[model samples]
Target: RANRDHAAGCVTPVISQNSLISSIAQNVLSINPFQQMINEIIKQKIAPLETRMQQLEEMVQDLQERNDCLNYKTNDLAQYQRRCAFHIYGIAENKEGNKNAIIKYIGKVMGVKVEDSDIYASHRLKQNKQGDDC
Candidate 1:
């Protein structure tokens, strides 16, 4: 039937140009205010969360930097403490060499009495390029 109507050139209820424009305008008017309100609400909710996230990131970065600095300081202090410990050089090595004898010899040279108890540990270091004793 519709095909017969088109073939007979009958006029359908064609929407006019004014009708199309009015429909589009009504849709925009109905949706625009609601869309704007939703957008404003979303911005209000997200702004504080974004600010808090940025602050937390900054705090984490600061903590990481402080931890790195502490690690470096600890390493430096450990090296300095090791430096305070003694290393006896140019001493002759003997199979019978012991901690007591070594401490006594060192004390006599340094004009101080060194007992075995005062020595925390004693060992012979491997000879390097200079073949020093420890």
Candidate 2:
């Protein structure tokens, strides 16, 4: 009789476990459709934002390329201007001398007739204590 009672007790626990598993499975099945609907709604809301992000990334890339091109052109223009520039050394530093005086001196000493209109601008640079032009 004791052995029979022990066997019945074990069977009771097995039945309770089986019912618990069945209940959990039913709850999951009921929630599956609701979860799927929520996921779909989230995806729908994010789709436009994802597309706009892609477009913004493309715009940023295009702007960077344009900036690089402009920088290259600016450097090229600087080099071209430097090529046309001329520096006259060994000339006396006259604090009172202006652009016209320099042009006249060039015409008299170098015998090169430089027109006033031909010269855009001229100025004496200051020398540092180390004798370097600043």
- Name the best candidate (by lDDT): 2
lDDT over C-alpha atoms for residue 79 of model 2: 100
Model 1 — TM-score against the truth? Answer: 0.63
Alpha-carbon lDDT of model 1: 0.83
The 0-to-1 C-alpha lDDT of every candidate, in the order given, reads: 0.83, 0.85
The true-structure Cα RMSD of candidate 1 reads 6.4
Each candidate: RMSD to true structure?
6.4, 4.1
Candidate 2 local Cα displacement, residue 87, angstroms: 2.0
lDDT of 1 at 11: 39
The number of clashing residue pairs in model 1 is 0
lDDT tens string, model 1, 1-134?
98998855643334465678899999999898989999999999999999999999999999999999999999999998797487776677888878668878879898998877877778877688664442
By summed lDDT, the worst window of 10 consecutive residues in model 1 runs over: 7-16
Worst 10 residues of 2 by lDDT: 125-134
